[model samples]
Target: MSGGVDSAVAAARAVEAGHDVVGVHLALNRMPGTLRTGSRGCCTIEDSNDAWRACDRLGIPFYVWDFSERFKADVVDDFVAEYSAGRTPNPCMRCNERIKFAALLEKALALGFDAVCTGHYAKVLRAADGSPELHRAADWAKDQSYVLGVLTAEQLEHCLFPLADTPSKAEVRAEAEHRGLSVAKKPDSHDICFISDGDTRGWLAEQIEMEPGDIVDETGAKVGEHAGANAFTVGQRKGLRLGRPAPDGKPRFVLEIRPKDATVVVGPEKLLAVEWIRGIRLSWAGLPPAGAEAGEEFACEAQVRAHGDPVPARARVEPAGGDPASGGTAGGDPADGGPAEGEPADGVPGPVLHLTLDAPLRGVAPGQTVVLYQGTRVLGQATIDAATALDRVG
Candidate 1:
C-alpha cells in the first residue's frame, strides 16, 4: 500500500471481509536521513509512515520491505535506457511487472500469505473452467487494466484487488471518512511517485549520459539544436528551438529521433501519419489460441499508446522469422534498405508482430506499447518496434 486513500480503504475492506490482513509498504528508495520528509507519494519515508498509521488504526500488523536496489535496476534504469534509445518507455508497466507482481508477490508467498492485494482499479474473474482472467473495473474511467495487463496467470492466481469490485472513487472516499481513517481525505498521487514535480526529462538527464544534438528536417537540414536527444520523445512539439515558421506557418511535430546520429527529426504534420506498426518484446496474460498464428490475419482494435482510442486493424503475428510475404506493407520498401551491420536500427533483432491499420494514425512512436484487444479482453501487447508510413513499406 502507498498510504493513499485508495490503498487505505482497500485494507479496510479486506479486513471487513474477515481475512487476517497485514499491510506491507515497500521501501523502493534510500535517501539520507536528513533528506527525509513527509509526502503522500510512494517510496518516501512519509508515505511509509502513513501506511503504518493506517494499519495501526485497523489493528493489523504492518512492516516496510526494502526493495530499493531491485527497483532501481528494473524500473529506473530501464526508464533512462529507453529514452536514450529514442523510444518512449512505460515505467508504470515496468513497475507492475518487476515490483508489484514479481517482487512483492514472491515475498508475499514466502511470508505465508495466501494472496497479495493492491488498490488497483481492475478485476479478476474465474472462467467456467476455473482459469483466472482479468477484467475492467466497475469504474470504466479509472480502469488500470492496461498497466496490469503485464501480469502473468500465476501472478493473477495469487493476487487480490479489493477495490476492483468497489463503487466510484467518491464512494471509496466516503467509506473511509465514515470509518474515520486518517487518510480519508488524502489526495491521490498523480504523477510518477518517485519523480518529483513530474519532470521526467530532467530526472533522466541527471542519470543518463546525454549529449546535445541537432534538430533536423526530413531532408537532414538542420533546423535547430536541442539539449539532448534523450530529452525529447516522438510527437513532442514544445521546447523545440525551430526559430522560423514553416511555409504554411503551421507548427512542426517530432517525426523521429535518430539516436545513432543524435538528431531529432522534425517535419510537417502529414509526415507524422503512420499506417504500419511493428513491435517486439511481446507479452500476454494468456497466449491466444493456436489458430491465432502469424500471417493468419485477425481483426481487433489495437491501441498504439495508452489512453488513446483503439483503432481498427488487421494483425498478422510473426513468430521469430523474417517472413516478408506474411507481413502486409502499406507500400514498398524504402529506397535505402536495412541498417548497417552491428548498429541498432529500425527493423533490427527482436520478436516481431506486424499491424496494418484500416486508417492512418498520427504521432505513432516507437518504444510505446501496442496493446491488442477484442473488446474488453486483452489479446496481448508488443513494444512499438517500428512505425512507418504506408509509402515507406514495400
Candidate 2:
C-alpha cells in the first residue's frame, strides 16, 4: 500500500471478505518532502502511521518493508537516465513493475500470504477459458490499468485488486469515513509521489550533472539557452523562453531533444506529429495462446502513453535478437513494408514485439509505455524506444 485512502479501503474490504489480510507498506524511499515535519512522499512516516492506524481499526496486522535500495536502482535511476537520454519516463510504471509486483509480491509470497492485494482502480477477470485478464475499472475516469499492463503472468496469478470492483472514489472515501478511518479525508496525492514539490526538472537538475545548451528551431537556428537538454520533453510548449517569434505567429512546441549534441529543437505544432512508433518491448500477463508464432502479426489497440486513447494498429512479434525494429508508418504497414524478419520459426513468441501506428500520434515520447489491448483485456506493454513522423523517414 502507498498509504493512500484507496489502499486503506482496499485493506478493509479484504478483511470484510473474511480473508486473513496482512497489510504491507513498502518503504521504497526516504526522500524528504515539505509535507509533514518528518514526511517524505506518500510513503512518508506520517502516511505509514496512518496505514498502521487503519489496520489497527480493522483488527489486522501491518508491517513496513524496506526496499529503498532496489527502488533507487530500478525506478529512480531509470527515471533519471531516461530523461538524460531526452525521453519522458513514467516512474510509476517502473515502480509498479519492479517494486510493487516483482519485489513486494515475492516478499509477500515468502511470508506465506495467499495473495497480495492493492488499491489500484482496475479489475482482474477470468477469460472464458478461466485465464486471468486485466480490465479497466468500473470508475472509468479513475482507471489505472494502462500503467499496470506490464504485469507478468506470474504476478497476476498471485495478485488481488479489491478496489477494482469497488464503487467510485467518492464512494470509497465515504466508506472510509463511515469506518472512521483517519485517511478518509486525505487529499489525493498528485504528480510523482517521490517528487513532492512537483518540480521534476529541478529535482533532475540537482541529481545529474548538466551543461548549458542551445535551444534551436527546426532550421538549426539557435533561439535561446537552457540549463540542460534533459530538462525538456517532447511536446513541451511553455517555459521555452525562445526570444524569437515565429513567422506565422503560431505557437511552438518541443520537437526533439538531442542529448548527444546538447541541443533542444523547437518547431511549429504540426512538426510535432509523429506517424509511427517503433522498438516497443511488449510484456504480456501470460504467454499468448497456443499456435501463436513469433513474427506472427495481429491487429490490436495500442496505447502510446497513459491517459491517451488506444489506436488501431498491427503488432508483429519479433525475436529478441537485439536488432530492434526501425521506421514504420504511424498507422500503416511496418517500415520493412512486410512481415517482420529474423523472428524464430518456433511457436514461442519472444518477450518483445514491434508496433507501427497507422497514423502519426502527437506527443509520442520515448520511455513511456505503449500498452496493447484486445478490447478490455490488456495484452502487454513495451517501453517506447522511438517515434518518427510519417513523412520524415519511412
Candidate 3:
C-alpha cells in the first residue's frame, strides 16, 4: 500500500467495490530509514507501520515482502552503472519496471490473485476487443502514467488502479481522512528513497570511483577543473567553478560528460537543444499501435521526465540492432550515439526506437526514458541511448 494516503484510500475503494483486497508493502531496503524527514524519502520503517495500521483499520490482511536484494541489483546498481558511464538514470522508473510490476505482480499472480491493485493515478480502459489500454488519469497534476509506462500488455491485464478517476490528490487525502486512515496527513515522499539524505552527488561519490577532471568548453579548451566528473549532469550550471568567465559574458551549462577521459563539456545554453533521440530496451504499455510493428514513423508525444511536459514528435521503431548505416550522428560519442556497448550484432533481433521532436527539448541526456503517447494513451517507452543537438545534426 506504500504506507501513504493514496494507497490507503485506494484499498478502501477496492474493498467497497466488493473485491477481496490485501495490502502489500514492499521492503525494498536492508536498512530502511527509521523515520521520515518531511517528504525527503520513503520506504521507512515508519511507513511500513503506517501501512499495517491502515490495513488493520480496513479489516484486511497485510504482508511485508522483502525485495531488498532484488531492488539493489536492479535499481540501485543500475543507477550507479549509468552514472559511471556519464548517463543520468531514473531509478524510480527502474523500480517500477523491475520490482513493483514485474517481481511483485509475478508473486501475486502465483498466489492465485486476480490482479495487483495500486494507488497510481492512471487508468486501464478496455478497448472494444476487451484489450487493456493505459491512459493518463483524471488528475493530470498527479498522473504517474509516465513511470508506469513500462508495463506490458500482459501485465496490464492483471492490474487495477482505484484512484484513476479521482479529480485531485486532495480528494484522495479527503477520502483517507474520512476512512480514519492514519497516513491521511503523512507528507508525500520526494527524491530518491534509497538516499535518505537526498545528497545524490555525495551518495554517488561513495558508490563510484570518481576522479578530478578538466571542465572544457565546446572547443575542447579547459575552462576549469572539477572535483569529480561523475557529479555533473547535463544542463547543470551552478557548480562549474570555472576559472574564467565566458568570452560572451554569458552563463555556461554542462552539455555532456565524457567519463572515458573524465572530461566535462560546457557551453552556452543553446548547445543543450536536443532535436533527435535514440532509445533501446523498448517496451509497450499494451498492444503496439498500428504500423509500429512495421517500423513506420508516426505522430506522437514524447515525455522524457516523470513530470515533464509531453512534446510533439514523430517516432519509429527499428528491428533489433538498429540500422547500421545510421547508427551514429554528426556529434555523438560512440558510448551514446553508435550501437550501445555489448548490443546484439547486426541482423540479431533487438529493440530500438528513433525520434525527432517538432521542437527541440533542452538538456536531454542518455539513460533517461522516453515515453511515447498518442493523446492521453501511453503507446510505449524506451531507455534513451543518445540525444543529438539541433544545430549539430549533419
RMSD of each: 3.6, 4.5, 3.2
What value of lDDT does candidate 2 attain over all alpha carbons?
0.77
Model 1: residue 357 alpha-carbon error in angstroms: 2.8
Model 1 root-mean-square deviation: 3.6
Write one digit per residue (lDDT tens) for candidate 3, span 1-394.
8998888999999999999999999999778756778898788898899999999999999999999999999999999988998889999999989999999999999999999999899999988889898999999999999999999999999989999999999888888888899888899999999998899999999999888989999999999998788898988998789997899999999998998899999999999989888777889898888888676779999999989999999887776645444453322224433333444212224567778899989989878899999999999898887787645643
Quote the lDDT for 60 in model 2: 88
For candidate 1, write residues 342-381 as lDDT tens digits. 2124445544566888888888887788888777766777
Q: Candidates ranked by lDDT, best first?
A: 3, 2, 1
Best by TM-score: 3
TM-score against native, each model: 0.89, 0.89, 0.93
By lDDT, who's the top model here?
Answer: 3
Compose the digit string of candidate 2's lDDT tens values, residues 77-169.
988888887788899899899999999888888978778899998888887777788888888778889989889877888888988866689
Candidate 1 residues lying further than 4 Å off, grouped into runs, are 32-41, 323-350
